[model samples]
Target: MAKKANWKELMTLHLRAYIPALVAFLFLLPSPVFAAALSLSPTNASVRVGSTVTETVFVLSTDQAMNAISGTISFPPELLQVVSVSKAGSVLSLWVQDPTFSNADGTISFSGIVPNPGYTGSHGLTISIQFRGKRAGTAAISFSPSSQVLANDGNGTDILNDTNSATITVTSSASAPSTPPAPSTAEQGLLARIISSTHPDQTQWYNRPHAIFDWTNAQGVSGVRLGYDKDADGEPSVPYSEPLSHKELDLEDGIWYFHVQEKGSGGWGPISSYRVQIDTVPPLPSTVTFPQGTTTPSGSSITALFTTTDELSGIDHYQVAVDGKVFTVTADAGSRPYQVSAGPGAHMLLVQTYDKAGNFSTANGRFFVTGEASSFFDFFSFGWLAVNYISIFLIAFAILVTLLFAAWYIRTHFMAYRYRLNRQLGLTHAHVHKEFDTLKEAITEELLALEQTKSKRSLTREEERLIVRFKKLLDHAEQTIEKEIEDIQR
Candidate 1:
């Protein structure tokens, strides 16, 4: 019985909970309670130059509308102008005017269905138009609901009067495309710039003509080259491309001009002309002067003066040679403008100058070096060298003779004086002469005895024996005396 009661209680709760839901579903089950309609706010508009104009269209229904709709509005090439168009719908349509119609009459239209309509909600459509007044006269344009053209509401109703008007005043045409500023003469000139020569120091001969042309507007030029001169001195114009080269023409020493022209699909561009001067005459060399009576040292430098000139071909170069050896010169070294240092002796210089047109001149001259002043020592030469040796020998001989005399004087005088002094001092009367005389006398006596004995004992045997013995004794004594004499002499 308790389980049956619980089941009955649960069924009652469920049934009560679903009763209100069922009633609400049945009440809101219809499509909508209203029909859609179209209307315009203000229904008309006005505007002036530099002012804005707007047109608005609205859609309504007796009850409510559910479907969404969208469409575009286009205008003629010349009529009212449309700046911007806006609409509120599920899908809004956008329109643009052709650039050719930028100044023409134009209009904008909008059509789209209402979106996300609730069970009891009413739906409406709105369109807003924006445009700029561009002229000084009256301009009119219109807009309307496109959906109502063929279709009618289910209850036989029509809501198509939602179209609106916009009035605008444009008081002037001065802002038209033809009112741009006109170009001046200079501005109308060629769109190119003048370019200076690339290298200022360069020059060329007319026979071997070479030139630099301003390529400021390379895009504007087609082909460029030198024109011919029939009247030799007249200005040359730009002609068709020619097979002749500057080498074939004589362009030396004169004023000249070149023509540059261009061509393109638009048309030919203006011809641009540039002027250049050609000079070929060489300058006169300077006068060369060497200082008189000058001589250079082995590695010293000397200077020479000279002259130079250039009327046509400006001075180009110069050189100085000493015995065919070229003296390397600094950039500014010259005779006319300046002078160059030459080696000792004579030098030949050739001054060569050239102009822009390749004209040149050559001049040659010589210069000398001055001899240096002399000192007394400078008078000496190899010739005097022999005298040096002679004087040396003479001095040596004199020294030798003096030494011999000095030795003899010292030996004789000093030795004799020392002997005398020794005698006076009683050291010893060294009778050297006496000693020598004694020695001589003794030798003479020995010789005499030997001779007498040899003569007296020639035939007797005992007497010969005695004489021999005596002679032996005498020889011994003579030997002793001779030794003593030799010691004293030394």
Candidate 2:
């Protein structure tokens, strides 16, 4: 018991570590894992050679909430030719791969997932097939033994069970309508399937009130009785005479079912139903937002969350636009944060989400992008890098100051040099030699006058002192002028 307990404890710890990964893995699963019975409607039927017949494939019964389903229906290519396949009123919310068929392979294949709360019903339609009879023979339609179903059963378990197949007996006038023979109740369950043309896709919500339903009227079939209502088991009450192959209705905005029956000489046949979903109103107005607030750090991308809801048909796709330019249209990112690529600036983000019915709602918000410049290139786009804003501003300020100081110093030195050149050339300065010569002659004459005055009157003490200062000044002036002239010439 201790060993067993320890083993369970270890497993619990392991699961705890992987819980997130497991949840993600299960959420994306496209096949149901619950044990469910799969069956083809009208399990047995007879078709005239060269004529077409319709069959529906759906989940017959399941006790668990199955989230995903996948299957392949195989038929004998020699006896039956593939006509078409439709998933109009299917229970699948998302198709991993759309239903497709190949006549050469005699197979119809589909893989899809249902939303959470999965699907629990007797008749969860998966897909419908139309096959044409080629010759007189028995063509058996059966699900491949390896069909799959997935469920949210606390574990990612995949469970599949045996299938209830259909037997198609193609004949050559063996049971002609002119001399009709009674068929087994199963073979005559529904002679044909109901199909819509004006509202072809049952999964899509449409605004058009006008609808047209068409069906194949088997041989000897006279009138058709049909009923339009919201009830699933709605019976056919209105009757039209023979040769009627279609019916038309102008319906209101709601889910509607068209029940149809055909009457030959033997009385009313079994009824079949077709679904028509109508939604004229658009998705409720909602917003798309950036989780990191409206303003984001300048980066390569920003994530947007769309909060648009549709109660009737559900949300389908989302389109994102930045600064009036459409960026991306996505179906996967509708429920999650969608990443948007934009340059740093004030940006207008316009987001639009569409419902499965083609109705859309729009919301927009404004945001700014900024950051430290990554490199020299960032200087041009200044705030788009991952650097500190204060630091970037300070660095830019210092660079501007340095550039201005350098320019000032260069201008100052150039002006000083030009002043010296002008002094010698005399364009913007006093001519050094000419002015010096004038000053020298005046000084020499003044000195002579001072000496003469001194000799004339033994000179007053002031006169003697003046003569001495004049001689010294003239001598100093001569030496300074000579040096400047020599330097300018050099």
Candidate 3:
């Protein structure tokens, strides 16, 4: 019987431990639900005050088939103003709510659904939001926590597991030149007499495949010669032709310059010129490359190498933003390897490449900064645990100091008032005076206890309530004493 009892006890102990382990294993198992993510393209941007910036939102499905998505993106209205919201390339076929934006509140919202056999993979483009920089500051474009991506399953399971946000920096307009330089003397003189041509006006844009050159000389000059080339020089591939009133020529799509000279026994005067641009297509988009994930030490900056290329017009400039702050803008293609200083925290860096013809492309990466808390006041340190403790300590210290000063001031002033009232009323031991003295003593003791407690921990809820009660009692005693003094004076 003793052996059987021992065996039963051991079985009970084993079962108790096994039950929790089984439950934990079950809980750790993956759920049937799928995970989805949403992110912003060109996740960062920088613009000058009064300029505009645009970014696209995208949705991706990791494992689930998504049928519907709804989300709201918020921004700081003081720094950025919503200009427009477009759904031109959105993947969702059915629109439950059209994308809309408000400048007043700096919010953009949209909701849409895909038809049966719900969309999968990258849900292509979602929507594009345009914002005009209103001030010189950094602003975060974030998705509201309530945003949702619903699965196609009949239950409408929320599959949203992650969301990425974007940042915008509005800088002073003086960062870049605002206007082009004035025309040179030769350019001015040549531009004066260049008559109209069949191609297009001087310094104008044209998409035509051919150009008809024409000239006029009311002086009835001996001969007129013409030279044309894509280069700025007067020397053309075909060389100068004999005097001709008009000539038809086929030309490729690009900027072309034409020079005309009049030969009136002067043997060809200075070459007069006009220019026409024949850009039939937009400049090719630029490619931007940067480090994927980087970690930097505390109090240090991370430098991201960036390379870009443009086939047609060549790269013009690059803009970089870090953690939603505008870091720098380089006007030349040679400017590579951008860098930005960051405090301890996770940050996103973005780079934008622009071609000479204004076409642009963007690339972004995520990085983290790690470091220990430098001091008690360095509450912004990256370590999560250290920051929490320091924050609590600072808050408690502020409250304790404020309460002590208030208590001391109130006690001193009220005591003086009571003494003056007693003298004025000629009452050394009135009921109001006695009550005031009792309350004053209570308040002084409570304040002393609070000061002592501050050395240990923050004020508890009960202690805060007691402080409020003490203040009320002091106020009542003051009113009673004032009423008695007024009666005695009358």
Candidate 4:
């Protein structure tokens, strides 16, 4: 018993001694720390009032890879005005929302997505903003609380930990020129006019693989040498012998600079470079989903989300067409819901998304609007006119039944009453005529007998008087009977 108690006490002492150590070990273990940082380069800057300074936005990653970033930057509009926002050489593959700035509002918003494998290094350029100092004051530019750095992980976890800002000190000075001066007429006459039908604007992007460049050879120009490649400053190296004024190139999808040098009488003149941007494949198909089911009451609302990315140039705009009424929304406004002014029925939401390169893909979405809360004006809508077939049929059927009931009622009631009245009047007229004829015949016979008796014997005084009175009575009766017969005929 003594040995057993000693062993148990030793075990208890050991347990009490190690419990604190175990807890400390657990606490000392390295915990996962997110180190994604959004910062502005040259945290300090200086410029005179009316002069311009550019500030760059960058994302710094520690060990984890980040795939998306979005933020709104705020500044003092009274002291500084945003000149422009440039996305040149940005590491992000696609712009979720095109960078926009407002000088009056003193804010800039940017959101973009990186392709697979994402960006992992420091100095991942997001955008550069040029600001003009408007007053002599210290201006602070910093990311708003809305800024976020999303990890490349499938779930898009936000790992943004720290955000750094910039400080700018502006002094009073004169404003710079609003724009650069145009080239002189003589300088413009020196270079050949370059034109392309397929890629008309050098700044614009197109999906056409075949790029046709046309130029007019000037006087005294014998030969022209041209180079086409990704290098913006490279000139024609190989000697050219083609005399044609046009050249067509079948190029892969990338930015290419076309450099042309005309061999004038004196020698090769200055090279004029034109940029051509192409993307043959359209943007990948996007699945537009609604949080609410495809069926929604007419009075309710539905939200649609479009998640699409372009490998090269980013999406520019989106179009939604329902019930033949088409409207457009920019990618920045893509988060907005499409207004459905259609009647209750199945509607095909024709969606057309266009990239910056003008490459586009057509997609279809369907939604059914229940007739739960329809307005009276919906009957006059074009969608109602074309699609409200059931309502129209019901109305037509009701009208037809109403017309049939009216015809039956008229035939049974009014027509029968008219026939009965005419019949009753006809019988009464016949009876009156027969009674009048019988009475007249009887009176005529009595008078005729009396007149014969008078002619056969000598007339007494009483007989003559009676005969006169009977004649008068017969005359009055005839007049009254004729009046009664006329009334009956009428």
Across 1-490, the per-residue lDDT of candidate 4 in tens digits comes to 9999999999999999999999999999999876799998779988677556778998998689999999999999999988657676898779888787778888999899999898999888888877778898899999999899999888988999899999998766443432234545443444767899999998788888899998887776777888787655467775676544778999987667787877765666767778898877676666777766788877666567665655566678888887888888888886565555566778887878888888888887788888654556655675667668878899999999999999999989987887887677678767866886787688778878878987798778887787789778877876886677567555
lDDT by residue for model 3 (11-121), tens = 999999999999999999987767898898777878778666677899998587888999999999999987556665688878898776777887888999988778788
Compare candidates 2 and 3 on lDDT and give the better one: 2
Clashes of 4: 1
Per-residue lDDT of 201 in model 3: 60
Judged by TM-score relative to the true structure, which candidate is superior, 1 or 2?
Answer: 2
Candidate 2 lDDT at 52 equals 59
Per-residue lDDT of candidate 2, residues 415-469 (tens digit): 8987887565553125656776788788779878877876676777887787788
The clash count for each model shown is 44, 9, 1, 1
Compared with the true structure, the alpha-carbon lDDT of candidate 1 equals 0.47
Over 4 Å off, model 2:
1-190, 203-207, 300-303, 324-332, 371-490
Report the error of model 1 at residue 332, Å: 5.6
lDDT of each candidate versus the true structure:
0.47, 0.77, 0.71, 0.79
The predicted structure with the larger lDDT, 1 or 3, is: 3
Q: Which stretch of 10 consecutive residues in model 3 shows the poorest summed lDDT?
A: 281-290
Best candidate according to TM-score? 4
Residue pairs with colliding backbones in model 2 are 31-150, 32-68, 32-149, 32-150, 33-149, 33-150, 33-151, 372-385, 372-387
**TM-scores, in order shown?**
0.27, 0.38, 0.35, 0.41
> Tens-digit lDDT track for model 1 on 153-176?
344233333434444444443646
Off by over 4 Å in 4: 1-190, 200-205, 222-246, 250-257, 270-337, 341-347, 355-358, 371-490
Per-residue lDDT of 490 in model 2: 55
